[model samples]
Target: MTLGLIGRNAGRLLVPLIFIFGFYIVVHGHITPGGGFQGGAVIATGVALLLVSYYYRDCLERFIPITNFKLVESAGLMLYICTALAGIVVGSGLLFNWLNASGGLFGHPVAYGVNPGDLFTAGTIPILNFAIGIEVFGALSVVTLIMFAGLQEKTQQEEDAEAAESAAPLVSKRKKGKGGRK
Candidate 1:
């Protein structure tokens, strides 16, 4: 995802749109071919695009808190667990499709319809998709951050080494030029 070509420039402009599309894919996953893992990876590419651009990359890290990533990850896990437990409490097997019955927001006995394999259909699938999405995004962001930090550290070390080498010979020459006159 290095930024230097026409394609990369074009991608920078398209990244936000891609992210939106990815979310749509995840949300509609029950009806469609795509799911949380695939959509989350696509969304991560949007962040990779920004990182590669080199413009405002440092500022991005400052504005996005790492804590937010951790919180999202934790919340996703908890939601998945609680949802599975709800199935058990209702006498449905763990992760059983209790929400599969149609027409009621709460289990209040509205008209029952068969699950349509669509987004409007209720079940554990959508909730699980959301959980995977959050986990994947958080993990990818942390990995990218660590990689950039390592690169920056290597760059700084090289610069410091060069500066020390340049200064050393100059100091030695000055001493030789001044004392040799005696």
Candidate 2:
């Protein structure tokens, strides 16, 4: 069963805000209290809210499908691993902070203390955060969608079984038949 019209409308209205908040958390991980993982969880929570507000089949058709989610999850994991491997290529060890102080993209050095945070600093932290965020979002969203669909299928099967039982004819237990065991 799905939520009423008001709930659905509310969920639809909140989706963009939820996504923006999640992205904000991810992008500001280095300067704030949240990170990629937390941001992704927030995004997944939004997806869960959508699932609750609509029917599973409708969600599958209208929003992110399970297949697409799986693909995105796989791509995110690959990208994260590739980002880590980049450190090895640069001779800085695996996942080493190579981009710091390099004056390149995301390579600015941080000042000594009590300074304003630079968005382009922190080396590979931002990249890794993005990768992890996408991975977590896709994984959790897909899992929630699949579980909802599974439960719906189970309920439908049970209902079908009940209907079948109700439609079947009842036979008397005391029928005298020639094939009866004596």
Candidate 3:
């Protein structure tokens, strides 16, 4: 089959996979090479696919409403700031590690092994990764939606203009044919 057909047919399957992979990268960021930024960008790819395949005018207005995007983006930023501030409260410098407790809730080890080099050894890194992930995802998704909305609006306006131009000449011709009385 052609590439176009494959892309269209597989988009439904591929989009979810992209989201899962992006989440995996974000969650395991501190342990591996991937991080929030990478994961958020990856997730954005899924959103992009949806935007490309569907009519985003309604979807953008409904799911990614401008007001909602603004709110989520602001909340993500505040959460990141508060998380960083938490480091200072715990006697560690900004974005410091191991100032409070390592790992997630319940004192579970963030990484494997007892040493700092382990996958879960990083203290605040994972939290930081999560915070950055939310922020980046919100910001990028909002930006994408905004751009898509703008493009759609512009295209619609152009289509309206073209239709009006085509109809205007036809109307004028008809009027002239009718002796220009009306």
Candidate 4:
């Protein structure tokens, strides 16, 4: 069974809201509490809501294509690796904040003492968060799609067995009496 009309409508409305909120968390994560992992989980939860509200076939066709998710996953992972590798190529340590205090682009100088937070001041953190968020979201969505699709597909043999079982009549037989007569 699937969601009723209200549930389906709610899911449709809420999914976008969930996505925006998730992105917000990811972008602001360098200064705030929520980061890539948390935001990714939130987005995945929205996808799960979609899965529950609709049939698997429709979800896969109308929205959650596995290949698209896989592509996104790969892209995120590649971006993360490239960004990390950039530090070493620039003669800095791995995962270094090479852009900090350089005064261009993501190289904004961060105040040493207490001050208001600047989004770009965190440098590679935001980029890392973006990459991780994308990877997590894609991986999770793909996993959900695969699981639901597998459950929904019906094999010919399985269908036949179900049909035969349902078509068969119910019969009861009593054991013979002690004397071999009833």
Clashing pairs in 3: 110-120, 111-120, 112-120
Residue 8 lDDT, candidate 1, scale 0-100: 65
Over the stretch 29-110, how does candidate 4's per-residue lDDT look in tens digits? Answer: 8888999988988898898888888666644456657898899999999999998999998747787878767786667878
What's the distance in Å from true for residue 145, model 1?
1.9
**Candidate 1 lDDT, 1-182, residue by residue in tens:** 24557756787679889899889977887677888888877887787677666433344556775667677767767887888889899755788878665455422332345644445555567778877877777777667766765565323245445656666666677665443222
Comparing 3 with 4 on lDDT, the higher-scoring candidate is 4
- TM-score of candidate 1 versus the correct structure, residues matched by position: 0.68
What TM-score, computed on C-alpha atoms, does each candidate reach? Answer: 0.68, 0.80, 0.67, 0.78
Please list the residue runs of candidate 3 whose C-alpha ends up more than 4 Å from where it truly belongs after superposition: 1-9, 99-120, 153-182
Please, what are the lDDT tens digits per residue for candidate 2 over residues 1-182? 66678999999999889999999999889987899899999999998988888666644445767899999899889999998999999955999888877899998878988887888989889999999999999999988888887775433345445655564444234432222222
Point out where model 1 deviates above 4 Å. Answer: 1-12, 55-57, 105-117, 153-182
lDDT of each: 0.67, 0.82, 0.70, 0.79
Q: Give the per-residue Cα lDDT of candidate 3 at 156.
A: 35
What is the lDDT, from 0 to 100, of the residue 80 in candidate 3? 82
Say what the RMSD of model 4 is. Answer: 10.1
Superposed by TM-score, candidate 3 places the C-alpha of residue 112 at a distance from the truth, in angstroms, of 10
The candidate, 1 or 2, that scores higher on lDDT is 2
Model 2 residue 40 CA deviation (Å) reads 0.4
The model with the greater lDDT, 1 or 4, is 4
